[model samples]
Target: LLLFVYESDASPIDTFDLGPPNTDVTVHSAISTAELPNTTNTDLAHVMKLEQQPLTTCWPGRVLYLMASNFSDKQKWVACLEAAVKSIQRKDTIVRTGMFSKTLLELEGSRRLELNCSFALCKELVLLGADEGLFCVNLYHGTHAIITQLTGFKCVHQIVYISSLNLIILITGRERSVVTIDKRMIHSRIDQANSAAKEETNPIPHTVIEGIVGCTVMDASKCHGGSYMVVGMADRVLLMKYNSEMKSFCLRKILLTRGITL
Candidate 1:
């Protein structure tokens, strides 16, 4: 496993381990180097050329976020957030068009076919709009829906996972606050509005937390079948506990000092 250590004024430091649990951590400095070439690129290029294709392709919009979901078999699927409408194109056809074909054609005929294929958007989405409000996308049964808007927050820092309750907790750096959204509620709303129109609606959030002040770095990890979260603020770290009844997290302990500032 890899461990990342971040300092307030310095670049992030990383350490890697390849041994058992008793192994001591071996720290390594970050390497600033060019990307290594993929071993399969040569084979891919040959196949593309044989199929009369182009070597490069581009997506339609600016990508805002990307995430991966792992399966039990260790396979992973990627989810992307783009500024505009998202679509998937066939790689074979994309190469044949030299990376610029908006439409495809049959080799033996004059018929034209569009290469745009619409897909369902990802479920656990957090879109930070220009207004600094978070717009969440909830997907269920192959349908996409929007949940509640998280306003009065700026610069969403990170999302922590709560595996026991299957919840996603969002932390904000601007407000030094945290909020939790009910995953089940989002799924239920999508099911209830399955056949309805695709208009946006505002639903109440599970919980909203505030009153904390400063820039904060939040981190979470699962251990011993439970989740523990740590929030590093100006001078100290705050420990929090996930409360299933409240559907939000509560601060359990606060380590305070007077020497920390943003």
Candidate 2:
């Protein structure tokens, strides 16, 4: 099994290949756009473009998935994928240099961009306080844009994956309680904002995780099973699980360790 990860400016996408080793898995290869029309291999894969800009604070980008194309004629498609790669690389270079002056307010002001946030999944950017928030410029439209904001006025720490339910787990603090929101809600907010500019409304939907097990400024949260979320504090990690059988989150386990400290 081989896993390929791709990182844009913000989040990462990961994909895996499960096949016999060295058995000609060349169908999935990451190639640049300039390498098109030339044949070095037969198998062709999907092409992906970095959707977000790179962070300036030195945080490395997340690795996404392996290339997989839906087009016919894998070899020819590979050529197209190469072309996309070159285009993305060129665009990324320009975006990185341009992001310095493009703050969220400036982008929103000139473009009428709406902003929202959530914790359930990893966002391309987080909009902080009044001055510091995420901002993105429309290369295609030449407009400045800011994505949605999280429900609870807090900063997102880490996002965890729940394989059993196929849901993203979020960890946020500096505010009371943890919250989870569905990805669909984000789309709805964006659509609503676009349709109704004069309507004074709350854009993002929020579900708060109540009943504090413990508190810490810097901590990591993990989902175990059911509705339970385990939080790692200074000296211990508390497991908070939802007993669907009971319809409420409950503390299930507590592990103490020096290294496990969040």
Candidate 3:
């Protein structure tokens, strides 16, 4: 048969005629465009001017650089691409677990800080112990301000909060003595100081822990919801228990270590 075909859609299929068959005729099927792989280069430099701040896109095996018409459009494109990357990375447990590296709040201070160490008393409050003095900072406040300062101690290294007795123990580095402050007294003084004048010369009243030489590490059971305390010195470890009668902590047992180091 003899076949006539038209490439344009303006002509109907019935307009073509099929004549008597001829043995010399040959027919071939068409190859689909979808079956062919894209071999064209997708480089942004070749597509547009290089000064447009193009963005690079990445996948498993293929990479493409996309260009935007303007700078604002480029920013939007970059933001969208970053969001997509974060969405995929979040599916990984290890990656999601370590993603919180952003800083939420920063400590602000007016004077020069000589901070040696710090301790978190609760979710909102943190105790900063320094050579200058001890400061109480509120973390959730708008300003993150140091609400109060307790003077009378220097070279403070470690701080412990005892909830049972409402006491705060301060351990000075290399000092043989420790300072104890009552939480009730601290709160009362804070209220008074807010309306009263600032006193720089007078120091706050605190109990002094004496007779312990070279006090290095001091931990209390109050830290663990107990009433006992353990103090590690240069040569010995003292086990002290709280005495409710006198409203103070007293030495209950002392283990001396002459040949062993604390």
For each of the candidates, give the backbone clash count. 2, 28, 2
Alpha carbon lDDT at 245, candidate 3: 84
Higher-lDDT candidate among 1 and 3?
Answer: 3
lDDT of 3 by residue, 1-262 (tens): 1122546556443321111111111111222234223423332222211111112223222123334555566666556545544454455445335444545345555655678778776676667787766776657764544356765667787888877777888887456477678876665665566557543323668987767667777877654554877888777888887777866678988888774334
- Superposed model 1: Cα runs more than 4 Å off: 1-131, 136-157, 172-174, 190-195, 244-248, 257-262
Best by lDDT: 3
TM-score of model 1 (CA atoms)? 0.40
Kindly list the per-residue Cα lDDT of model 1 for residues 1-262, writing each as its tens digit. Answer: 2223434536435422222121111211111122224424333222110011113433221211111122221111111111111222332343435534443112123222122111122444433322234444433312323343343444555565565666656665456567666656655554444346443333635566554566355666666665667777788878777665765557889888686633
TM-score of 2: 0.39
lDDT of 2 at 36: 46
Evaluate model 3: give its lDDT: 0.58
Question: Whose TM-score is greatest here?
Answer: 3
True-structure RMSD, every candidate: 21.1, 16.4, 20.5
- How do these models rank on lDDT, best leading? 3, 2, 1
